[model samples]
Target: MTFFLQNFFNGIMLGGLYALIAVGYSMVYGILRLINFAHGDVMMMGVYFAYYSAVVFSLNPILSFTVAVLGAAALGFLIDRVAYKPLRKAPRISALITAIGVSFFLENLAVVIFGAIPKSFLDVFKDKSILEKTITVADARIPLLTFLVIIVTFAMFSVLFFVVYKTKIGMAMRAIAADIPTTSLMGVNVDNVIGFTFALGSALAAAGGIMWAMRFPNVHPYMGFVPGLKAFIAAVFGGIGSISGAVLGGILLGMIEIFLAAYFPSVMGYRDAFAFIILITVLLVKPSGLLGKKAIEKV
Candidate 1:
């Protein structure tokens, strides 16, 4: 039971990260119906931005993390304006290809600038209360970081929930989601609403990237690739375009991967494949996901 608790705790920690990243995927898909392949790269940029802000500028780590998240928010808006906005009227295929192109561009651009080597971000986790403290569960000691992740995630969810359903801006976003043309006709600035959605999603991704790097203690140009893809899979599992679904899916996926690796030591090497396998199962079993609403097409 203690062993199960330990692995479960680890899975929750990982799920927090996955849920944040999955939010970005769900938001973009909900708005544009286009998967921003570059979303993960945006997270990578945030990691580096925070890294340099701490190491080069010698700023406080917390302050650097804030700057990194803000920078990533700005980057999200920039990507939409520069790459996606132009193709707004273009075919969905065009936007998808462009998203892919942007993904590669960010990855290659990072390689040119930051090189292929991974940088250490151990200091980001050092000297922090959350990192230093641990609580004993029977015989197992659980890191405070796990609880920190959960607390932060729920806090973020609250904020996002309010922003999406309560605010006037959120109303506009929902309006756009319902029908962009109708929303535009209602005098809502579709562009601005979309931009804000991107910004919000990107900010969350940045936060996830920072947390991920702090836990993993390394940053590389391609670091966000796997997490991004896995998060995307999580989004799908939870039902793409559904916010709550994304979170639920991410948590379940994380738990599955962690527990699978823990209980099935022989298949540990194939842990990554488990996400896709689950994705396939979900696609076959329940395409709309656990909480997703099935769409009705008028014939």
Candidate 2:
């Protein structure tokens, strides 16, 4: 029972992180129907931003995170204006290819700039001792960082829910998602809303990336690739366009991955393949996903 509880807690922590990144994928897909393959690279850039902010600029944690999030948000906005906006009227295939190009561009740019080596994230903190603290609950040792990650994830999601459901800007976002042409006809600044969506999604990805580095204690140029892919799977699994669905999918995927590795140690090496298997199952069984509504195109 103690062992089970430990894994469960770990699963929750991992799930929270995945959900954070998944929300980025879901929001972008919901608004633009574009995959934004560069989303993960944006996250990688965020980690680097925080790393340099702390190590080079000598900023504290609060300032480091602020710079990283804002910088990533700006990057997302710039990507849209530069790469995607021109192809907005072009075939979606063009946009999709462009997203891939942007992803590769960011990855290689990081390699050129940050080098191909991994850095320790914890070493940048002045008081790393606080993060290393642990609490024992029913014979399970849980790190304070785990609790912090979970709490932050919940708080961030709360803010996201409020923005998406309660605010006027959110209403405009929903309107655009429902019918971009009709929303433009209604006098909404469609381009601004879309840009805002990208910024918002990228900001969330940056937050997730920061928390992820904290948990894993490593920062590398390619670190975001696998997690980004997994988050995309989670978005599709839970219903790509639904925020709540992304959360659900992320948590479920995290739990499954943790439990499968825990119980079947021999299959640990093949764990990554399991995500692909799940993706295939979801597509085969329900193309609209668990919570996604079937999109009907008006001919």
Report the number of the highest-TM-score candidate. 2
Per-residue lDDT tens digits of candidate 2, residues 130-159? 777889999988888787877777787788
Clashing pairs in 2: none
lDDT of 1 by residue, 124-215 (tens): 54465665578998877777777767776777778888998899999998888788898999999999999999899899889888878867
TM-score of 1: 0.95
CA-only RMSD, every prediction: 1.5, 1.3
The alpha-carbon root-mean-square deviation between model 2 and the true structure, to one decimal in Å, is: 1.3
Score residue 297 of candidate 2 by CA lDDT. Answer: 71
Off by over 4 Å in 2: 297-299
Candidate 2 weakest lDDT stretch, 10 residues: 147-156
The CA lDDT at 161 in model 2 is 85
Best model number under lDDT: 2
